[model samples]
Target chain A: MGDNLISVNNVSVNFDYQENFISKKQKIHAVNNINIKIKKGSFFGLVGESGSGKTTLGRAILGANKISSGNVIFHDDERDYELTNMNKQDLKEYRKKAQLIFQDPYAALSPRMTVRDIIAEPLEVMKITNSRQETDERVRDIAAKCRLNIEHLRRFPHAFSGGQRQRISIARALVSNPKFIVADESVAALDVSIQADILNLLKQLQTELNLTYLFISHDLSVVAHVCDVVAVMYLGHIVEMGPSRELFKNPKHSYTKALLSSIPSIDPEKRSEAIELKGEIPSALNPPPGCVFRTRCPNPGVDCKGGEITMGLTEVEPGHWVDQCCVL
Target chain B: MSHLLEVKNLDVKFDTDEGRITAVENISLTVDQGEVLGIVGESGSGKSVTAKSIMKLNPGNTSYNEDAEIILDNENVLQFTSKQDLKKIRGGKVSMIFQEPMASFAPAIKIGAQMVEQLLIHKNINKDEAKSISINMLKRVGIADAEKRFNQYAFELSGGMRQRAMIAMALSTMPKLLLADEPTTALDVTIQAQVINLIKDIIKEYQMGVIFITHDLGVIAQVADHVAVMYLGSVVEKGPVNEILKNPKHPYTKGLLQALPDINNLDAPLSPIPGNIPSPLDRPTGCVFRTRCPHHNPEGKDGKIEMKLIEVESGHWVDQCGIQCGQNG
Candidate 1:
């Protein structure tokens, strides 16, 4: 196996937003110059708030979102595939190697389809198995791994609860034997106990299948528990990136620190004097120059307002990277 | 000796197409002026139902038991039949901030106009006075461009701004009680923090009794002075926030605390409560939580154990689930 499963180098994805014929066209910088390398079988987390572009970045790596600049490289045992420059057939082949688990289980699955049909659909579309018997076998295998029994395969999506429905969603994603998966807030909709159950299931599957995950979520606590490497994104830019333990222990960027402090704790003493960022996150359409977080940064220097920091990361510690402007 | 709000044996049932279903059962809690009582629970726990019952905001299909009482400032809210009395309770004496700000707001009306209309109806104030008061409230909630926002519709504001505006409108009435039902659950973490801080400051400034309802225990620790942990429409555990968090007596409470992925201790495997919460129709006989409770004693006390709250400590109360009652009290 290669050292890195996926290498995203200086990739940026921007969307053209034009409300109507009367309105002026504007560029929404969804993923701007992000650089990340996911080691084989590592759980890499993309953490951010709403409008932080974490999901956009995840979709870009999954070859779903159109990239505006740079490239994405997917490394396998045989060869490396340039995801950004794939033809139709190559793209279809790449789709089988990678998959996405949606956030809302209720909306992801079709009500008309039984659990077996939902799981088998992925294999059928991906052309993984030949006949109905083979498809059924693959469906049952993945469902059992996801903790869904053979009896559950006959029932429609409405018959299952939120957590069970999510298990069905996961089984569908894994049925194609994907090497990598992008779980986009997969457990965000479930209750706490169910959320934990799903998280544990994900971890167990990862080890069993030797899977690499790009776990995108707004919750830092959940990310802390599961992810081996973490990247903190804000307003289309990655503010901090490093090993989860190191980054959580010693966060360098101001935005990273503020985001960490925002996680509410069960102990009242822990939340006291937390770095309460001023104002809401700025829109990606017209983010503040220099540092995007300058508007809400707790301590912005005089140069921060107008002076744009060089658009790249500086390794502050052994394996930690922070935006240069935020290091000050 | 009178409390700001006291809910005595609040039993709520809804007449559905099938039959009458118990939505909330024998739930009781009190909130004094300048105090915050947090109601923590997952879905089907009926925390929101308990909160809505205070303002009697549930749908027409709902029916309260004869012994159920919702007393607000010594007035029985259940018996309030007159429109004026109902008006006096809603927005006059009690205000509610919902999880979704857009749902509470009138989409067609200007933000300022709705605030002014509520003030005009409840406060016997002039239009000019109401407008100024509404603008002041908008400014107090830290919404920039207060005048511009006042003219804009609900769709114009961002999620955070909409929540702040809702909070401003809810507090502008200067009510004695505030029922915040998952007010920050929809917002992002940073926005959630800002809204939480705003609520804390508003509580101190206005001294409004707040009933904060959410599934997150972390939020409960931040905003609640006292907390009630609910499970399947019953308060499983009730105590001071510190005691409940640090040393929970109920198995459900302990399970909930352990289920949350502790940021400090990342290595410990998450122990989710064993199984899915039982469907309401198939509610467990003895204790509602017994189906999934790790400490479930299969042999119940004669196949019937009436749910009762046992005073375990000076202030703390836990449900008399035979397993925990004797050991705790």
Candidate 2:
């Protein structure tokens, strides 16, 4: 009853750009030494800017990206599989347990395929269920769970709006009855009104299925509404990890505070000056040494320059962990 | 004094394959010389179309009804049919910034070149003067290393930088009016805020009439002096920002304001408007929002939708037949 669904222990993914026969390679640390724990039935959020390597961390957990080092273990009620060292057969089985819900619903989905086929593709490819009737029933069940109209199952992706298409994407991801799902910017593309509808649906599905989610998005407000716990990433390193409310209320990192301040207030008279970041997000290929955020940090000190950026989740308060300033 | 820009009883139609579709209808608003006017609506609400119409930027198939009158600086821009007049209106006086920065900027051309070109086109400035003006504009938008970045192409810069570059280019001409259409929707929240503040600053510095078009209520609340809440291409509610935000009159506007996630109040769930934006083909006969209006009757008597825009309070307007608004108020 007190088991963890997924455990990412200091996992890092590095993409090596090697040239000709000389083997002069450059390593781009996309996800650098990230440690996160997803509870059996919890919505965990991973938030950062575009080049923060949040998406890479999600992919590392999902086994889409090659884990350069460290352990990523998936512990179910039944058994625990070491994700980093899984063989072909074991990895294939693990694929069924952990599925990905892509961000761009339009691009992720095939225009040629009907909604039914899109949903049924997973079941058929995985051989989870035999026969067309079985596939049809399974597709319908998941589609209904995702609040998709069964009548529209036969329609093409073009016929549906952005929100409806996202629902279809969700249905396809959950058709195989996966225990864990990574929804990367799932509602970012949708309109504000539609974003709420999708968020409601996701919450409902999480409770109904008792599913674990690794919701990745740059939208802090949306993350606040749904996620139980959140990890703030900056240039491949997670600077802060804590409960959503705690993080929102008292952000430890300077970047997190700046990000929080940037959110526009709905009240007309209550407008505050947004904390403006000076320089753009540095390139991942040629990342700055020492603290990855030192370039953009408003309160950067001498320690931020030479000190190596590491993810040490120090207990800021009860159940709240934040990476402290190592230089001091 | 009269407003800088005045749009009254505006109705724009496009001849599509289906039929003549009314994109915008009965939108009446004004923007003072130094005031920022926000026109907000969801997709298919004709927010962008309305802004484009001010510059006479509508497509060839667009059929502007006779009832509409778009007056810019006491001159009727709705009747601008010739290319020369439209050009003068577009870049010379009323400059625009589009949503997709990459799509708007040329892929091969340097950011500096494009800005200088835009400046030269409208102002007939010398090459050296244009270059200096472009660099200054870039600096104004908070672009670090403006001199260096001016040489870089659009793709070389990040999304936020590209948008800043776009704004710098648009403002370089020193246009009287800035028509920004969903300018910051594509950027991150942090970037969006930066752009919004930059726009606000520029609007104030230039004392220019700005019409900011967006789907976000929060943004409009922050930047706009007066906001016109649009639904199905018509101005449902038009008033001061405070009035619109604190006490929204229109059902569509109320839905939009409520839909925004209130960070201050965490207890209340985001109340997104139920049902999708109605298709242009299936637009209602009477009120455009009647089909999706939660308050209006779906199955009314006499096959006529009775819901019409009514001034509910001293400066607030709303639909007449609000079924679910009493509880909301």
Candidate 3:
């Protein structure tokens, strides 16, 4: 069927320190050798705790971060575009096909701008519309699709609640008719009830617009339900990758198991049995040499403690990959 | 047994530029020594306001109802109007850890200096003793290299470490009560678990009453002995944590439970409350949640049920409006 829309091949994003007199020459490898293919219309989830480089990877996919190495290929019906080496002209065309929905609704939308202007900024900036009338028409169409009342178009961001503000951001992201959407912790700031509403809206929009979502979040439960496939990141490395059901039902990596168990369950009794990871996430600047999770991994393999090992994925089962250092 | 802190008819209203907004309405809850009373609610549900009222921490333009009373150790806390008395009440007898640690700490001050200052306020200890105790408190909260960290500022520490330092400062006084207002909400899940576990252990060790305010039921189930589910200022339902999770009665509580994404049961559909939380200015007449209540009854006078929390089961409470109008068992 060959319907893979975006394939990330050995994508490594490194942030090099400025070589000033006082500064030492060091590099922060934000994303290290990541490879994953997002299907045409599937909800692909990239989940990890903070500082796990999940956000960096998501931004790398969007061409926001300067890639140190590797290439990202975007497949359309007509041609294959190398996202990493895209020229200005290509990037402009690529911008229409890919969009990003930010996490903080309060910070993302400008208080000075009206809801309509916020949604129309992308169209005007990208020169996707010929006239102001065309931009207004497209903004109104997307706002209605996002369930925003027509009267809300005139109001500023401060007048709307978190959920409504998020709806506005979603409408803004979708105004350009992007096929690939990267919603990076879009509902993390929302209340539980409101989070569900936003999530439902996202799902509905995905189907109606025929969109492929790269949902990045630290909350595993939310991703487990919303995504078809899940990739668990740990310190710039993907420790586990599999179908959502299979990953939750049978996690292969030690880090994945610890993460899965650490989620506070609604059932009060489940708290006691949680496998508590001993310490906080290690500094991303200097992660453990052999296994990135060795410092906090509940169960470490023989070579995991201090020895250097190749950071590679092993197909533990069909369509299920685990980090090579996993004790199993 | 006497409660460490008791809030009765606690109604808080803020006189804003637009209009007077009712923050908390006719609220009542008690926290016994060594007990954790969780107040769970969304942004505008007034859980933070209730927590703030305990320490008289609400800012200017805020007014407590005339009949409102908070009893601490058999003494009324509201009467302590003088700075002399409020100074002792603020951190000496009751300490609070906030959601954002960086905001609470003075950027100019060192972590050790802040903790030692708090310790000195509550206890008549020498500077050296206070510093040692501050270091010990930092160590107790699981911060590595406590001695080094003690000299550092809030900005120097990582998020989890900063939160730990905040907890260290809060506990340095050995206060009779602790008010943790969404202390772990901003942290990652793993760090959140660690903090929750730390709180659980400290709760056992200190036996001091704690008022844990958060919006997540999952966190409440972990750290709380009893939970009060607030909907737009009023506690719609409350009870023992087990009873609240296993057999929630109020439609709002049920809706919240349904909204939670069950990691184990990922297949189940999420039924979030139908409508957005009504703005405080346009809040419903009597049960504030009636606008979004799935089991709303039109029979109540002007579509408002008498606001009352009734004990439907042992240690479990459901708002009278919910019970009377609820169509489901």
- First chain TM-score in every candidate? 0.97, 0.94, 0.97
Cα-based lDDT at residue A91, candidate 1: 89
Q: Is the docking of candidate 1 incorrect, acceptable, medium or high quality?
A: medium
Writing each residue's lDDT as its tens digit, candidate 3 over A1-328 gives 2799999999998887655968787888788899999999999999998988999998988899888899999998888779867899999988899999999999999999999999999998999999999998999999999999889999999999899999999999999999999999999999988899999999999999999999999999999989999999999999899999999999989888888887888888877567888878877666667778888878777677764666789998899999888834
Off by over 4 Å in 1: B301-303, B322-329
Question: How does each model score on TM-score?
Answer: 0.98, 0.95, 0.98
The residue pairs found clashing in candidate 1 are A290-A308
DockQ per candidate: 0.78, 0.66, 0.77
Which candidate leads the pack in lDDT?
1
Model 2 TM-score relative to the real fold: 0.95
Query: What TM-score does the A-chain of candidate 2 achieve?
Result: 0.94
Model 1 residue A15 CA deviation (Å) reads 0.9
The C-alpha RMSD of each candidate to the native structure, in angstroms, is 1.7, 2.3, 1.5
Q: Candidate 1: lDDT of B3?
A: 93
Docking class of 2: medium
Interface RMSD of each: 1.1, 1.5, 1.1
